[model samples]
Target: MKYTVKGTQEEGVQACAKHFIGNEQETQRSNVIYPDGTEVAAISSNIDDRTLHELYLPPFADAVKAGVATVMCGYNRLNQTYTCQNSKLLNGILKEELGFLGYVVSDFYATHDGVPAIEAGLDMNMPGPWDSMTAAMTYLGGNNASLWGQNLTTSVGNGSLSEERLDDMIRRIMTPYFHLGQNEGFPSVDPSGYFITAVTAGYIQTSRGAPPARDVRGDHAKLIRRIGAEATVLLKNVNSTLPLKTPLSIGVFGNDAGLPADGMYVLGDDPPYPGVPRSGYEMGTLSVGGGSGSGRSTYVVSPLNALMARAKNFGGRVQYILDNALIAKGDFSTLYPTPEVCLVFLKTWCGEGTDRASFENDWNSTLVVERVASHCPNTVVVTHSAGVNTMPWAENENVTAILAAHYPGQESGNSIVDVLFGDINPSGRLPYTIPRREADYALPITNMTGDQSRNASAWQSDFTEGLYIDYRHFDAMNITPLYDFGYGLSYTTFEIVGTPSADLLQKELPPFPPSSQVEPGGIPGSGMKCSKSRLSSVTQDQSPAQLLCSST
Candidate 1:
């Protein structure tokens, strides 16, 4: 928390820790169809106090402690209350208990009632062009202004809100800018004069008049390639099939061979400006997913292209096949007799506003893998996704290896080929647990189809697996995961022969510094009651393999 907040602040950018609370699932934020034929306000996460303190709220609390500049409330509900208007969340927990001096902002179009939102402690509403459907309730007088403008007047006139409170809101929002010298008299309006004056006053002095501009592309590319290679988690490998030898005849199958560049939306079929051809758009691979927060790159080097380039130098050849047609027809063969080795590229799309349709690799992709493995004993599967996907083909005898290259930015292709050809070692670890079945997740996620079928005001989600999020639930329930947290494989193996010990302290860690602790009960004078903290901690011994990986 300290690193994320302070580090970004030091970089001259205010780090806003976002989607403040209870924003785990993005299934339906606007409206939803319940089983019965009615539409509703969408599903909400109902988190008990124990769950909130132990699992959901700690990171946010830490962010506040670290002096994050801003906090953006999510587009969901905390318990039955909409988070943007939940006074307990905004005023009570965040401002009071956490001592968050930073202002609170609403998610895009997340603000509903203006007066209530302000009273609840929201300092700003973001990204104009409000939702047309809610315009009536959210519009103030002027052409694109939010309802807050008019609501504040009405509220103050009616004594529902005080002028002092409004001033407090303005003060909170302006405080950080003032501290950063960004207030009314700052010379953003005249930066040239400001720079000249600073230089004249010796505040902007430098040893050299100007520095030489270095070509950093090669350096940046090298760093990106290294990051990508280290992030390529080898999930499975059998019979020493990886780190392919030279003189390799590789048959590459699947459209994923050309992995897209980063910054693509996590939803949607194509880029927004679709009328223009791919050639006219920024030069790069297609997006991995779609939605807000997606990225776009100027250029992308696909795995197929990278591998082909690498193969040229090694006296090796790569046979390319677009498995789209084959998969559609359920003809999962390579057509050509499988070469000495087959590399299958697979990808699944998932992101904001939708859940994955299936968890099993046992689907069509599995069929393609099964067939390819059957023909060529050496078949390696490379999967790129926005999240962890279950691999039912893990036990497939013919499948030689599996690599999880989850969203490997622009240099992914180069990274994958390097690992395959032994140019770089594979050492990435899994970031999350992959349960064998969708049901195995800590909490049950509502399916999009099911929600779409029903017309309801809102779907109520209960976080029954309180304090047992992700691997915690698996540990508590003794459920075996397909891939445990931190699980990953590497091209090389090592054995550890020593154990380091630490001295045991009889003292109980000094009750934690006050800054790191949250006092029980509600905020001092809000009259709002809150539960005592039910937070717990779990520590697991690092397996020998993990210790070795860390040392490496």
Candidate 2:
């Protein structure tokens, strides 16, 4: 979050730290799902003060410290009260406790009441004038009267919402503009140089006879491919089953391997209405998440075809059999049984507007793999998901290997093949822990029927686990996860050298010289960079320094 804030603002664009606190789950965003499966419009979040400060607020604190320009509050209520109207969070915690000086903005249509949110230190309500025809249908209803724009003036007139508070909000909003050189007598800067279509009026219109423009696509193609390769992690390689030997016959399964890759935040261009052609690039395979972060490119390489070509180039034969119906039924007998090696591709799509119904795998995925693993002992599973997912079948005896190719973009297939054929060594690390079971997570209860049976107004979530989230919870409970955080595998092996013993570290160390006193090649240098070729030199180096190296 800090790097994102610094990187964006350094480029002259303001970065907004979003969903202020306790938005870990996306359930009940636009509506509430009752215990009986009935749905109604609502949203809520309930977190204790300690949990809020320790687990949730740290990232935002880092963002503020990094000079984030804006903070957008989420739509959910905090502790039974809507976030936009929660003074303790926006004013007491974010402003006073964290020392945030930036403006506070509300999520779209998130402001349920204007006066309370203003009093709570919310500086802006988005998509306004607050009097738009579309916003009126939702805000002007009897269920919510406080959100109407007139309420702000009425509250100020009644002395319920002070004018001083309103003025402070204005100051917060205008401060950024003032720093951006938007003051009086300052000439407004034109943005014609920034946008592609602005400089060339007919640039976007191919029919207007303007030749196709050059882009960075051709130049950065290798970088994108390398990124995909670097991000593909080899989670399990028991018995060294990967980088298949030549003179082999391979069988590939799963629709994901053949599907065109997609996973963009937003489409390059989207028509306001149907039947209108999108002006931007064509989306070949839609892999992106829905809602806010969704965009598609013109083309993507199929992992299946890429593997087939690679295998053929290596003098090996390949066969692809896609069985959606049988896989759903937990039967793998329909697939060819003669191949020496079998590879399966698994995918889970998630983005905006909805959450996965459960952390457990759907029947079509892990369950099918379990069945296939039993049938084909040489099978290797490659998983593609937007985030961490349950992996019960990970320990199956028949499964030779498991590769986590997390939502690799357009070149996903090429990257997978690069790692699989030993062209590129896998070096990616797991960002979060994967639990063996769904119940192992901090928030076990979700959109299940009986979970939210009580009232229609909100659902209560107690952070009874406190600061024990993810690996911390696992460590505290002494429970083994499917894969611990920072756990990963590689084709090659490595070992550290010249490391002090645990007993030596337990003893107090002598006073060390400051970095300023040490020369670049001094005995007690700040750090050392080691290479695979320097393995034999490990015992010879006795310098008090930390060594860094990447094994791939």
Candidate 3:
């Protein structure tokens, strides 16, 4: 509703359906399909119809048809090519096919996504004063308008942006500007008046997105809760430390306990809550680099609250430790002279699609596990975070258990309790590799750059691993992630028929059902099975083996 109609008509703002083809969830937002919405867990693939119609492409189609005034270009590359500037999306489809006459906008700082966006037929590269080649061109003479024209004219001549391209883009924009009477603001007079109805010949456009049946703003919390519930997962349990079957005393630490709590969403408290740092510096600023709202986006849920909530359900009381003073120290003796299950909630946030600076949990997280192991024997770590991390904590034979709850939203506190108390199965997966450390990245390419092709690392960002960003790279390098991508655990086990056939792997997952589609769930972490199974290695350019299976 917001993207297609509410933001536009209700606010009188030109609603731009962003990321033309498919861009969502910045953690590895481009050139991938999270299938199940996990970024590190994405697979290299094209936009399938289920997504094209349901999730991926529809908004733009709707925008164009409904007479939306603009669309935004994506910052990341799609299929190894920049989308801000992909011609297939811009001139070919948005124009000739969809018949859109409105303008196109590049995402803030997406001038990189811009050149291709202009070639693709995007009209405005915004959050702009153009830079890079676009800036250089602007200095040369052509502003974005002329720079775009020059590039298109050149692309057509040299086969970069394309020639027939210039005319098609020009024609499309001109048609709306002139034929639509846009010369006089399309003669609608009032953007919200009766004139538009009379002039367009039809009030209901084929392209508009339908408004929600009701005001969902009231249920925003409910919606976020459901997403939290479904997305959370129990990753490990060495001795079955979860389901809090019996009532007992609890020991809690970290931000949840509050000696002096991190302001959270407020960013600058003890243990330090996350702040939106601009692209330029770590000092707090309103915007991150590229001048867009930082997606950290202000969400908070403390583990202590969740623990207390769960304990109440089972009839138990909880104690909080104040001050970093080792209430338990390396030993749980301070919290419990007698034994009780220790629960450590590790809250780690790596901006989406971006990998962590290190693969292991911080010393605090490890120390929590260390104390639990020394004193409480029965310990479980409920990690509330986004992305995956190699568990150095797992090294302790006594650590006992783990859970991967990817940024569960508002009701997150309550949801963790439900699952721990046996309400839900942790069915989530590690979206990317939990490599041992930064040095172990066979090519260490996940979330290395926020840019599409800017070279920043000592090792060149390798495209030799093209279309093979996730587990495929792992398989190729024969280097397994500490935790493999797509690794998820369920309360009940799922089995896939081991019918091995290479040819069969090429076939698509059974087409998405009418109501929903395949999110491409499962990776080697889930369990590895290949199509040509008798035993064989792969060569470069040859696809890292694929397996076709049936859930048995």
Top lDDT hit: 1
lDDT of each: 0.66, 0.65, 0.50
Better of 1 and 2 by lDDT: 1
On TM-score, the leading prediction is 1
Kindly indicate the candidate among 2 and 3 with the higher TM-score: 2
- Superposition error at 432 for model 1 (Å): 1.6
User: Looking at model 1, which ten-residue stretch has the lowest summed lDDT?
Assistant: 523-532
lDDT of 3 at 32: 33
2 or 3: which has the higher lDDT?
Answer: 2
* Order of quality (TM-score): 1, 2, 3
Question: 1-552 in candidate 3: lDDT tens per residue?
Answer: 234544544444455566665553353443432346533322222444343443355556766667766667775654545566667767777777787777766764555542455655666645344433453344335566534445545667776765565565566455545534446523233333233222222223432443222222465666665556556665666655655676577766443322113222322211112343311122111111122222232444445666776777777778655332354366344554443666665555344334345555433556656665666566676665545555776657666667777656545666666666666655565656676555555444344444432332211123343434456566667775667665555544444444333332433433521121222233222322221222233446464553211211
Q: Single out the weakest 10-residue window by summed lDDT for candidate 3.
A: 280-289
Instruction: Estimate, for each residue in 1-552, the C-alpha lDDT of model 1 and write its tens digit.
Output: 667888877655678888878887776765533466565665688888777875677788888888788999988777877888899999998999899998998877788787778889888877443553334223333365656766667889999988898888888887777765565454334334344323322344642543333233665778888777777888887876877887468788776775443333222423222343222122233334444544444457788898889889977788866554564454534455557888888776544555555665312667777767776778899887767777877778878899888767677789888888767777677768888777787465754455443645437777776666666667767889989777786655543333322332544533522122223232121111111222233336321111111112
TM-score of each predicted structure versus truth: 0.74, 0.71, 0.57
Which regions of candidate 3 fall more than 4 Å away from where they truly are? 1-104, 112-120, 127-216, 256-264, 267-301, 322-333, 352-355, 436-439, 445-462, 493-541, 547-552
